[model samples]
Target chain A: MSAINGQSTNGSTAAPGTPRTGGEVVCDAMLAAGVDVIFGMPGGASLPFYDSLYHYQDRIRHVLIRHEQAAGFAANGYARATGKVGVATSTSGPGATNMVTCMANDIMDSVGVVYITGQVARPAIGSDAFQEADVTGISIPITKHSYLVMDVDDLPRVMSEAFHLASTGRPGPVHVDIPKDVFLETTTETAPDQVNLRGYRPSKVGNARMVRKAAEVINAAERPIIMAGHGIDISGAADELMQLATRGSIPVVSTLHGVGTFPETHPLSFGMLGMHGLAYANFSMRQTDCIIGLGTRFDDRAVGKEDEFGPGAKVVHIDIDPAEIGKVLETDVPIVGDLKLTLQKLLPLIESRDRTPWLDQMNGWRRDHPSLKIPDSPDSVLPQEVVRAIYDISGGEARVIADVGQNQMWASQHFWYERPRMFFSAGGLGPMGYALPAAMGVKLADEKQDVWCVTGDGGLLINIQEFNTLAAEGINVKVAVLNNAHLGMIRQWQEFFYEGRYMGAFLDNPDFAKVAQAFGLHGVGTSSRDEMHEAIAMAHEYDGPVVLDLHVDRVENVYPMIVPGTGVNSVIEDPR
Target chain B: MNGTETHTLVATVADHPGVLTRVASLFRRRGFNIASLAVGHSEEPGYSRMTIAVEGSAEEVKQCEKQLYKLVEVVSVRNLTGAPAVTRELAMIKVRVTSNERPGLAEITDIFRGEIVDVSKTSMIVQMTGAQSKIDRFLDVITEYPIEEISRTGVIAIARDDVGPRNGRARG
Candidate 1:
């Protein structure tokens, strides 16, 4: 039989009436590989793949994004929120190029997303043909693995491998670049259900000997602390981590992305630890005798100027990735394994102890550097006040998706999360414009779930276009915009570091409410404390997408600030 | 070559279409120059060994080792620069020749274990395979006359297991 799928056919008959082109096989394989949704945009090179999606609409839901970047971010968000592998699709050239940042960010945060992009046909690949690009070269540095499928026969194997590499071991983004002809050609090969990658084995269970040693250290030290990270949520070890933390009288300090891994409302919680961390949390880290780092890479932002971050503390670092074992802080005992499995074995060996003195000392720091209170400023509303209002309105029931910059720090510093996977953000890459689409993706997981996107004007503008996606899909995600009339974080840095030279630090004013309204969302703008409260309440009661613009103080900086180049303990509290 | 000497890197990698590109891309990404590289089959089936001569500082080489190990298909890696080893490269030199120079050329070829594979009235092709230094010396002698062209396979080496960490042990 002859075919007209932009290439000569080989008469592949995968099913009745289906000629079984590579594109159809890819879509079929994805469905078989357990993909339920795909975020993508249509383009010339990706026509074949898009056409294949038409036949599988009942099996797969494709979220059409306005921009390819948002598609990738949405896929990443979906993967992070739900523990399933997410897929993003785009055409060749600029469409693929747009996904670079999301790919880079996903790898940094260890987000598992498989990106499928169309490529120029094989014959015209290097001729600088229209919509052509070197997608493999562009994605190699950012992706865990990338492929350029030159032949149609390699599609099934490549698809299987891409999904496997993306969702296995240290999970991150993987890319597959398929030529237009390959997607148009017919193939009969099947994607394998089992993978046999000898060189890619990741040690998932901790060494029993190291777990024993870690237990001994925890038992001997009177002021041992558990610093948990996002890996706890990824590996579904929150329950096990809580068990270990409760088994010992250990205080738990959460890394930024690990906000809800352990309930912030728990008694043993020391809140978050890091640069802009709670002052008491940083103090607990400084005063601790032993730091048991669980599933964290010990990023610089998480533990500023490591020399004093955990002074006089012996660190027992546990992680699944071997490369992250001693990549940063000096670890006395390294246990490399899945956090769930490691803690499961280690919990039994730990002995309970009373550490009243350590808890008392941490309480004293809390009294000294108290959590932010809504300031009595009549002229400008404090950003924390907005977070407090959102907390009250949501009753701590919504999953908060905080954007980078000032809004992220404010949400982390003020809002409370009571369950695991309740907070998601671009913690490692700190990308702006993440919260809006990420919140949309999170909402897609459960349509009835309350999801909030807390972003500043600077970040919200970066992905303001995503409002269309929210409105089009009828996703009722609540948005809170902290409008400061400046790039708040950079302005704060300039205020502290550059002798107040605010060049390129100011953001021209935009009524975010108006922009949101233009995108078919209910918009509310407020300046006073009472108005902010009413606006948040209105947003909560709204039936669809609601954008609340809170005009906040432009000069206010996130406090408990660790001055750059200063020790982590040398934090600057607000003017007392 | 950042003012550093060349060092040989021996790696056992999976034999496939994308494996070579991965190794090459890694070297490029890590900011190192592969002065010479020869990849061929290894003793183990479904795997290949690569002998790459790279130029970088000791610290850079250490970083490159970690980066290379991160590649999924890379099995083992060894730095055999200072270790006791044998290195070889094969070269075919087509040189302009005269009947008068035949005796001298024959004597030089004998010393270098070379053979005159192809000869014509005006030119001759001498095939020589030996240590890199030996090939350099032979080329120096041949270049004294008008040379037509020279083709060479990059240097490939195997470490003498008697020298260091034996029994299949390699540093990461």
Candidate 2:
């Protein structure tokens, strides 16, 4: 067959009228690879991939999101929900640049996602080809691996490799950049084989000696606390975490990103630690003799200054990434591997010992903080009250996807999640519009579970376009938008640190309820605490997407603020 | 050629774009000119790597390896100094020379058992394969002439078929 453009589009015999080209092969390969949906916003370079999507309409669903950035988040949600590889497609330049944040989110959270973007034709490559950006180069820091497929023959292999890499080990996003010509080229090579990445391999288990050392510390310690992080959930090690916690009778104090690793209702579980963390959880961590740190990056927020974060505690950090061991607080022992596997091994070696004094102390702190109390401030609805309602209705057992800002803080402090990984939030990136799409990812990851996308009004507006993606894909995700007219979290910071300099913070948003209705999903508006429970219950029962626009106190702050640089003692204690 | 040493390293990364740049930057910034470095596809598409290499010496390379792991993308690092291992490097050298320099090139090539890939009126590009020493020796001899450009395939090696890194021993 002759090469045309670079795709193998000419050799296949066409019926009397139907013309088969290189585009068809790619579409066929994409279908064969089990890609049902692709989220993207199109442009000139990606016309060929779009052309292929046109050919395979029913087989592959292409969702045209409002922005390319949202496309990446939507795909991430799809991947998180389905356990299948999430795929996002976009054209070059800004379309590709918009994907960086989402890609970084996947890298940080370890979500399996495959990103495809069209590059300018090979001939136009280095000339700063119109709309041509070095996507492969730009994404290297955030992807597992990336490929710039210059030749059409390399597409199948590159794509196969991209998907393979994205789905394995610590699942993450990978990019495959195809030039315009390559997307349209004709090729002679057969369908590409699953390229074996010879150098890539993830160690399934931790070093035995390290695991044994971790166990020794835990077993010997008079009071051991398990500080869980996002790694535990990303690795699907929740079961192992629970097993270890149960077997060892160890108490757990989770970081904000670490919530949902263990059920909040569990007797030993103290939800979230830090400035805003429950007084009991922070106190528990401070007093513990040994800290079994798993899957949690001891970000400064989790542990105020390294010295006082967990003072007097010997931290045995068990993380997949070894550098995190002593990067902050010195680690007495470091176990590197899948959190579940390491915990599974250490579970057997640990001895059950009750830390009655420690538990009593933690209980006392819990009593002191007593969670947040939502005072009726004028007509402003409290976000904390809504979370308590959801917990009351669902018993806090279902999965909760808390969007950024006050909604995230409220969900983190209020919603009681018993399992890890279920509480998905944009922790490292702290992207404002992360919750809804991530909630969609979480819901799709486990459909049977009740998934609530707890978001704020400002953040919800950023990716509200994905409501179309969610509705069209038939994903049952519940969205609770804490409709405070301002960007709650940033507003809080501005109120405290920046001296109330709003500056693009307060967001005048659309009627989110109507927006949901427009997308053919259920939409509800809540202004009172009494009505919040019934609304959440109604939304949860609906078999499709639903949005609850909650009117919350515009100035309500996530309290117990720990001024940065100051140790734990500097925490603002006035509840007023 | 001067005496050479080898060191192994491991790093944990955020598994994002430009991580390779961060990895490559370590060598460039530290001024530990990397003789060769190769990154393999990772098992957890976005995790860490047991990156093994041989450069500098036991002490210098070890120090460099530790710093490499400290880079932001780098999660952690370890140097297998006295551990069982294997090492290899791939290089493609295109040397420049006149007709008169052919014999010297050939004589030197013959000593190293190298192959001539291309021959032109002014220069002949010789391809050599071996440890860092063999390639270094060929380049050192050819440096006397107008050396146009040199392209080297960075080093990629697995421990000599024995114990598989650190994880293998744990299974036994």
Candidate of highest DockQ: 1
Q: Which residue runs does candidate 2 get wrong by more than 4 Å?
A: A1-35, A54-59, A186-195, A376-378, A395-398, A442-450, A467-476, A499-504, A514-526, A531-534, A541-544, A573-576, B1-22, B25-172
Distance from true position, residue B30, model 2, in Å? 12
**Model 1 CA lDDT for position B109:** 90
lDDT of 2 at A552: 77
> Whole-model lDDT for model 1 versus the true structure?
0.84
Error of 1 at A146 (Å): 0.9
Model 1 clashing residue pairs (backbone): none
Error of 2 at A371 (Å): 2.6
TM-score for chain A, candidates 1 onward in order: 0.95, 0.88
